[model samples]
Target: MLESLSVPKRRVAAQFVLPGGSSRKVAVFLAEAVPGREGGERLSDLLNGSGPRFIPAHDAETDAMTFVHRENLALARVAAEHEPNVVDPFNLPTEHEVELRLVDGQALHGIIAYVLPEAHSRLTDYLNSAPPFFPLLEEGGQHVVLVNKHHVAYVETLRR
Candidate 1:
């Protein structure tokens, strides 16, 4: 009980640049009361494991290393629990000015709005999961536009 009282709050703020040419800001729980190098370490581990690995992790059955994004795994859970075509009914998404650079050398400029994650929410990973299409508001919020995840190459912030 004393530990609970002494524990301070913590969280992680992450931004995802989806393959479909769209990006979104996400917030997730840190699972740590006092944040440190843990998050950076986790990201580093992921990056290091991306390439081929000839050495055994201790056995011949071990395969080459793979880059795994935890967010992708979390997205699966969210997708299973909700309808993919329609977003869960929540508060209106926040609008942000963003520029998307596509793999085909095309670009899309608009305001993307998404439901802000709950404060100090640990569920940010689940929220980062890439959907088939991201529903964004464009044309000055006059149209509900769908940005396919597969088509996106990268996303950039027009303004901080």
Candidate 2:
């Protein structure tokens, strides 16, 4: 009876690469709907939000629940549909093509969007001020990579 009182959640498949280079397939449960958002709680929200230090996920292969330390994640790949719409016209958004090199020697190329003040609008300033986990929209537009700023060795700006 008590279980019915809980908010509904849906499982979204994702791939997580740990700082040590281990990759895992897991399902993250997200709320059916967020208070102000149109759809469910996004995977980005779960990773970047200040909810907890550990994220709860279900192992895809074993079906066992596991808690991963948020800080240890190198990157998380999720479907584009799982991310919230980030195109904010009011902020005068800018998209930068970039290559993020991870500490584990893997490099990913994508476009990162940012809206910053004119005086501090460079890519360096954006990266420095961005949150720990930020979204990198993949080239093909099928996936979004939530990168851990802590694991990025350096970011090379490909194009403005």
Candidate 3:
């Protein structure tokens, strides 16, 4: 008799701010094996693999675990295979076209549409000319800051 292989569940929690100024929570589960890979690698495989087609966005971070607006459709489909309950309520646009003003007084515009949650406030405040923004780092046995999907300026990933 053959034993059945039981798959472990994977869960990702995130919060998003819609274009209408409303905030919502989202949870998704990627394949257990694929989720462990680096974000960029996973996305590359997903796109190049013979499974599905998802557009890659420039200006999007290549290593974040979160999905951006442009990738909403592809992510949704992938998530559905594992957990049908996971869905992207906000339809992601083909690209993110918003103009961002960085803390260094530089304006940046890109089609990237998602960011880490923990970096949201800092990014927002920086864009508003409130303070400087720095990437989170660990120093002296302590983390300098915590970055989540919200804190990111945009999202990127293919699948795997």
Candidate 4:
């Protein structure tokens, strides 16, 4: 019975800034590693594998979790019953369009990710943090651009 408890679950904490100036926190669980895998494999596996979970934050005053809950939930079902493949989220190049409104009164348009919630990154990785710069693909789809997160006022996902 003790063996069953050997697997470790990690608490993943994330804070996302809302469109309005408020921010919210989210917490979730992720297995530290597979039964017999290499070091740092847990995060990679969780991103590509079928299991990762969210425990909900201890302080639940608002619905800030609502904004990022979908992606978080999708990461946690655990294990692949069918195939054996792991996705390297850090390198994939798929993208989603989003609009960023800056505190300086400028609006920038671009694509935000290659993989949503990159490997080892909480699904909502960039929401509440200041970045060296958030790199993105510009709307013209020609140049790679970087935005300073400090100037980020709000974000809007422009579904295409």
Candidate 5:
């Protein structure tokens, strides 16, 4: 049996850039409270392995490494969950613009923005037309969104 874990209260925000070059912001509160295990298995799978690995790129002129592509996957998950109306890839605003107020007495907030349809297409293409990257959690016999910290616009961990 899994030991009862304390759900950490967290706040998140994000910004997305739409194809039209416009941006939108998203904010929310996340806690262990979302409900049953949603994307936990998938997340675990992604993190379980030796974490992320780095491989040298073939390009001699430029040097790059390959990892789990956590950023892209995380963004894709959020987009899949919210289906933001707009996404802006360039000139993203700072986290201060977006804020998430936690009702569980956990203070948190920030901003998240992404580049629109183009980004979506690229991500979807990679995910093989899978549902956006958002994870689902059981809440009152219904599924709800469980935001991940990696992609959140901003996160503040309060002092206990």
Candidate 6:
């Protein structure tokens, strides 16, 4: 009876970093299917979505379920493939290479690609209008760092 009413989900492994420099390995549960996507909802979507302020995940160290506060997270690291695609068939994405310095003094270097209206396509414009949690494709494109804007001290644009 319970199985019939259960929502299908998939576990995506990730590293959760707290604002104080602590880190944990966890498995984030995501819906098995979502509208407009074939595989599942990307990690970026889950972090940036307006659905909830807490993220449900399974803690590897504790071997238990845990809910992480979105605003308290410094960044969550996941495989690049698990991140949402920035490309839009109609509008080309704007790529900016940058270094994000967090409030805790940690710096992360990556490429932030986003699609914005022609009038607001600059890096500053995109950053100002981006969701609280945004995806940053790390150098080499192997991982996606979902950074919390509230924890970011500043962003420095790098020469491409």
Error of 2 at 56 (Å): 1.2
lDDT of each: 0.40, 0.89, 0.31, 0.46, 0.31, 0.89
> What is candidate 4's TM-score against the reference?
0.37
Worst 10 residues of 4 by lDDT: 74-83
Better structure of 3 and 6 per lDDT: 6
Per-residue alpha-carbon lDDT of candidate 1 for residues 48-159, written as tens digits (9 for 90 to 100)? 2343322112111333332334333211111111112233465654556777665766576766555546662322332256345555444454443345455567777677
Worst 10 residues of 5 by lDDT: 54-63
Count the clashes in each prediction.
Answer: 5, 0, 20, 3, 28, 0
Candidate 4: pairs in clash:
50-78, 51-78, 52-76
Write model 5 residue lDDT over 61-144, tens digit each, in one string: 222322223333332123333222232445442211233322222222323323334555443242244233333222222222
Q: How well is each residue in 91-139 modelled by candidate 3, as lDDT tens digits?
A: 4322223443322233333322223333443434333432122222222
Better of 1 and 5 by lDDT: 1
lDDT tens digits by residue: candidate 6, 11-91: 999999998789999999888888886878888788888889989899999999999987789999999888866577798
Candidate 4 global CA lDDT score: 0.46
Weakest 10 consecutive residues, lDDT, candidate 2? 84-93
lDDT per residue (tens digit) for residues 1-160 in model 2 = 9998998999999999997778999999999998876887988889989999899999998889999998899999999988855666688687889988998899899889888888998888889998899999999989999999999999888855
Q: Residue 63 of candidate 3: its Cα lDDT?
A: 40
Tell me the spans in candidate 3 whose CA falls farther than 4 Å from its real position.
1-7, 35-160
Measured against the true structure, the TM-scores of the candidates, in listed sequence, are: 0.37, 0.91, 0.25, 0.37, 0.21, 0.93
Clash pairs, model 6 backbone: none
lDDT of 3: 0.31
